[model samples]
Target: MNLNIMGPLAVNELISMDTNLLLAFFIGVGSGFVLESCGFSSSRKLVGVFYGYDTVVLKVFFTGAITAMLGLLFFSLFGWIDLNLVYVNELFLWSTLIGGVVMGAGFITGGFCPGTSFCGAAIGKKDAMVFIIGLFIGVAIFMAGILCGRDYTRPHS
Candidate 1:
């Protein structure tokens, strides 16, 4: 397989925009399939993590993180990827902490993370469907706030 050594394949124009999108679509589908197969589409599996009954979700995520780290390392070693070209988002302390708390509450109550919610919805799970709807509503509200020039992270002073 050919690889781009300069930078991100799509970002550096090594691949066409259409190809990039197509690749992303396939990867998303594959990931969803894997999640469902691992029973991640079921909210019970994730909720078990919090209750100390099941730890598969936690294990899977930890494994994923380690796998990604090693993959990036190997890719860089082979000149297939350029670490310098990678973009990392800026860290916001308060927002990040608040978001984590909110997301944790959602996961405990709703039983699905953003990605697993979609995976569950794909299989016609009603609760997952509702979660997705609520997710979209939340996104719309957040976007509206942003469009209206409301900085949620700041005080009203």
Candidate 2:
């Protein structure tokens, strides 16, 4: 018997778009529930990893990463997935460095990562709501700056 399971069901044409979207919605909800249950919705709990007061976040992050890597490796070995078909972002060193610095600054000053901010805000945390608002404002400002920069650099035609 021939069997093929080389990748995502969506890619394999085994799942309809509506079903995929519904599954994604449910998965997102489940993930949020898990995150809230694991105390990730709390800003203090998240920051505790940085302060050495709690390392659960770090441990959980690493465990998840390692598990994903191992699963991918095993799946490839078993011919269940095609590694070459995976989409990986092209590296831009300077942009990556700048983005990392900005993200780190936000994490330190805001006391909540983006994911936690959403989770916290979902649970009605005022600070998280403010952080999310600030994030949107920042994005707006950044877009404005980009638009201005583009116009300034455009050739007079």
Candidate 3:
């Protein structure tokens, strides 16, 4: 008889908006602290991955992915989480390829992925500040295009 369908917690009425926001704020701060401590705020560290020098980023990400996967599996097996309720985005081949190329180029040239850029900017890195500005501009342009009713999925002929 529960009417709320926004999310698992929302549907169950286990968390209020204020509590959720507080949790998110703490989580974000904790994530930022972890990023800073791990040397993720350095462009040199990130670029080193591409130059075949440092593999810490890859190793950390791989470990995180495996941990998350196993945690999800365990939760599902224990019936603590319903895997069927998870939302999955629809796959688009062309969009995926194009976005990957764009992101890869940005990573190599600017030495900052979106999350790392945020972390770096938080610590007052000039290059990261520029990257953050560019990121916002790109997002604004994309939003404008969406607002203009342009279908991004269709391949331009």
Top-TM-score structure, candidate number: 1
The Cα local distance difference test for each model comes to 0.86, 0.83, 0.83
- Clash totals in order: 0, 0, 0
lDDT of 3 by residue, 46-116 (tens): 88888899877998788978997998888777666666666656678787778789889989988999999
Winner by TM-score between candidate 3 and candidate 2: 2
- Candidate 3 residue spans exceeding 4 A from truth: 1-8, 153-157
TM-score of each model, paired residue for residue: 0.89, 0.86, 0.85
Backbone clash pairs for candidate 3 read none
Per-residue alpha-carbon lDDT of candidate 1 for residues 16-98, written as tens digits (9 for 90 to 100): 99999999999988888889989888999879988899999988999988998999889889887788888876677777788
Task: Report residue 48 deviation for candidate 1 (angstroms).
Answer: 0.4
Evaluated with lDDT, which candidate comes out highest?
1
Could you tell me which 10 consecutive residues in candidate 2 have the lowest summed lDDT?
A: 148-157
Clashing pairs in 2: none
Any residue pairs clashing in model 1, and if so which? none
RMSD in order of candidates: 2.9, 4.4, 4.2
Candidate 1 — what's its lDDT? 0.86
Candidate 1: regions farther than 4 A off = 1-7, 153-157
TM-score of 2: 0.86
